[model samples]
Target: MATPDAPPTPATHPSADDVPIDKSTPDAEPPPELPENARARRYVILSFWLVVVLLGLPLWWKTTSIYRAPLPLRDMQSWADGRACRAEFPLLVEVEAPELSDPEHLIKSAQHALDDANDFSAHHLRLRLASPKLTDSTGNNAEENVAATLKLLPGPARSSHSYQLSNVSREIELFYSPSYNPSSSASSASLSLFVANTLQEIFAEEQQMISHLLSTSTPAPSSASGDSTSGSSKVNHAEIARKMSRILRYSPTYHLTFSLFTGSGTPTSWEIEDAIDEYLQPLLGALSGISNFTIDSQIQFYASPSDNVVPEWQPDGEPAEGEPQRGKWVLKKQDLSSFINSAEWPLASITSYPTINFIIYVPADELTPLSISGSATNAFLLPQWGGVKILNLPVEKIDGERKTHLTREDLKSSLDTFAGQLMSLLGAPAHPSSLPIRLDSLTRQRSAELLTSASSTLGSLYRLTLALPSISIPTSVSTAVSSTLESLQNACQELKQGRVGGEGGALAEGRNAAAQAERAFFEKSMVGQVYFPEEHKVAVYLPLMGPVGVPLVMSAVKELANFIKGWKASRVAKA
Candidate 1:
């Protein structure tokens, strides 16, 4: 707009290089050259290195390092190697021969026979004489010290010998002819021989069970084949495998789920509360000493079996004309694994211990008169799980509506079978016909099992940590490991002392220790993010650290070169 008064403005701005410098103003003399501060340059280089060493390195380590908990690695390894503990069972047997002139002689002779008969070094028998005064005691005074009591009674003539075991007590009465008394001159007593044979027979099952457990728990020594007890200790591998497959793992507590599943809506109610109280409570009460059990019952309507109807079958021989064309609806042994769809039946209550499912399915009207294997038993056992029973109407009602309710009396037999299945699934042995005695044996077996399991878990944890050096371990893992070791030591000591009473707290300690070891070994934090690759880390930090490191490295190299040049010049001048 003011182009007439002033020189015409340039159409476009001129670049800095294109602009002309005015010569009218003489360039001011350059300021006096400042002295080069070699010290300052050196300080800059040193400061960069100091920051890297003092700050960067420590920060990287703090972020990338794995947290490892302190564990008794040596002790755990020793335990895994089977050097720390050797399991032993010293059973005490009391002989009661009040009729004998001297019971002490009989006990000594029997003990000698037992010692000769016993081949396994870990398990042995000790015989002792019972006091005559204990005979009149109202309560079992000697139950604490004796696994079993041998009582000798005088029998009538013509009866050589017979034995009777008291169902109510731990006493076994041996009826012998009055003339069979031990003679002072005879080196081997007949009475002692009888007692030894009976004892050997009575304990045969327990000995076999113990031998199987020991064989599976520890590594077999090379010298075992040369030892005299090797045959006695050796058990069939297939049998041991079968036993391990059938029984559930040891736990401090067990949850028992009793469910009534019906194909129709009418049979929705059950007298389950009363039935459990009347039929199953007694057994649970008896097992309370060894383990805690929580019972829950429910009824489900419109439920069906895995297969609704029977399939056609071809027998080995030719089919008969009169035989039913439809094959029996048999749940084959192989199909038992898929009998219960676990995903469909989520647990109602969350529990630490494993859930044992007991199912009673009532079929639809069309599939009534249900029978398992077309036999008297309508129940079958699921290995490591509970039992299943198919309930059929007591009165065959072809047209009538399905039974709407199940009374306590109607559920008694099925519940009884469920109780037996419960025992089997828990790994309890069926022997001695005494519930208390069987449970006691189960306690000892469970303790040994838990101890072995815990040791093996600890070994696995050690190996895992060694293999993956970058995995994180929390402080809780350390505390759990310590507790597990301490509890295992205490359990081992208790076993060594032959203190296997469930109420004495030894068995529970072993179970708890095993659980803790499992928890620590499988800690969530340690296993997660263990497989992150190094390439991914480079991809994440390359953009940020690349530019930052370049200038620092170049400056350091330049400084080093100058310093080296100065050093050589000084050396030459000195020469």
Candidate 2:
């Protein structure tokens, strides 16, 4: 027991050096990646890139690309330059001489004289014997195609050769002497010469207008003598230009607004409907063949003139002896221009067509008889807009109250002035004393104007397309341009055939062309695309492309680096 105790006290722990070692094999290095596995990984990355290139990229491009319709730029330019079509007007005049046994000779002689006297061949008149049915019992032209009816009547023995134009119809009465004979060569020559001279005088203004239009627009056709400027010296180009500037652009419809504006609360109502019906209906009926019109009326209270309309005091015909120095307010000529308070006036209409406003402004009692200096009239035209009249109405006292109202009689003069202004604004010629003839001239003028305008618009559109290559052109615009070109060609053909006015004529077709050209030029899609620049496209695409492109580029670079490393190692081993 003592020996065991001594051994236990001497016992000691084993040191790390004396510990026993059971050595197990260290973990083997991961097995070298198989060649097949490495190849499979590279192929996987390549498949992803192929999907992105073949499918994703093409899809994005297809979604973002703009659709542009092709256009015929060259054809458009040719039309604009007046190379595609040549416009000409050949008028036909009918001569009615029922009393003459041989009207054919008279017609032949007159035509010869007309041809010799005509300097502008494009607007030459051809004389033909009028058919019996062309004139009505009242001696007016029943055929719309006939410009005028020449009624030949035998004059009294004492009467001389004379002609009178009817104010109510398109008839020219030629009073030939009873001694005149169509079979006699000398008499025929004299009568033919007279007729030719009269016709020339009647159409002189129209010829000048048409010549001016041709000279100002496309190259004019040469005269019979091969001179284009033969009669250029006779044209008043400045006056024609001024008158054209005042006329409104052609439209299918027009809205006329008659407004009565008073400086005070009086004159709350007016018989404008009756006045228009009586004074304006006749003129409107005459112009119905050209354009349609819609009428409206209104009354406004407390409408004052512009601040520039300051009036000066003038004595009223030397005040009666001690009549408290009677005086009247007079507006100067300069003030007439600023008499309209457009800012406060409700001049705008809701119709889509153009609006022609006629205002009747009644002055206050304190400023009655507001007359323009150096002029007896108080009405003035506003040129392409409308007319204005200063109505100095006398206030009537009834039952201790003021009665201010406009009757049809009080507005007669103003309405007459408005009618005249309307004609001037509509480009009616002021000669020949024949309404139908004047309207015909206006029709030709408007047709020429609209044709030129449409051509100019087409040219501008073509230039715009060239200037802004990035702007998108829609299919609608292409269709509109084609329609416009077709209409222009039709109009030119109609003009060449001498169909100047009326529905389905040159004027109507020209208007259609102009409208279509405007629509094409102002297409909303094209205009919207104009502001979207290449920079904007870049800004829009960069964010989407950045994330997708970065990974693809990095993967490609890594794969390339690995491939180069393997190639170098294999080369060195082979060496």
Candidate of highest lDDT: 2
Backbone collision count in every prediction? 0, 0
lDDT by residue (tens digit), candidate 1, 263-331: 677576889989999999988887777778888888777775555344223334655798744433344
138 Cα displacement, candidate 1 (Å): 8.2
lDDT of 1: 0.72
TM-score of 1: 0.80
Per-residue C-alpha lDDT of model 2 across residues 169-219, encoded as one tens digit per residue: 668888887778776888889888988888888878888877777678643
RMSD (Cα, Å) of model 1: 7.4
Q: Which regions in candidate 1 have their CA more than 4 angstroms from the true location?
A: 1-39, 58-69, 132-145, 155-157, 166-169, 177-179, 184-190, 218-231, 308-349, 374-376, 397-402, 469-475, 529-545, 566-575
Model 2 has an lDDT value of 0.81
- Once fitted onto the true fold, the runs of candidate 2 whose alpha carbons sit more than 4 angstroms away are 1-41, 99-106, 137-144, 154-161, 176-194, 217-233, 320-328, 374-376, 395-403, 561-575
**The 10-residue segment with the lowest total lDDT in model 1:** 220-229
Candidate 1 clashes: the total is: 0
* Clash list (residue pairs), candidate 1: none
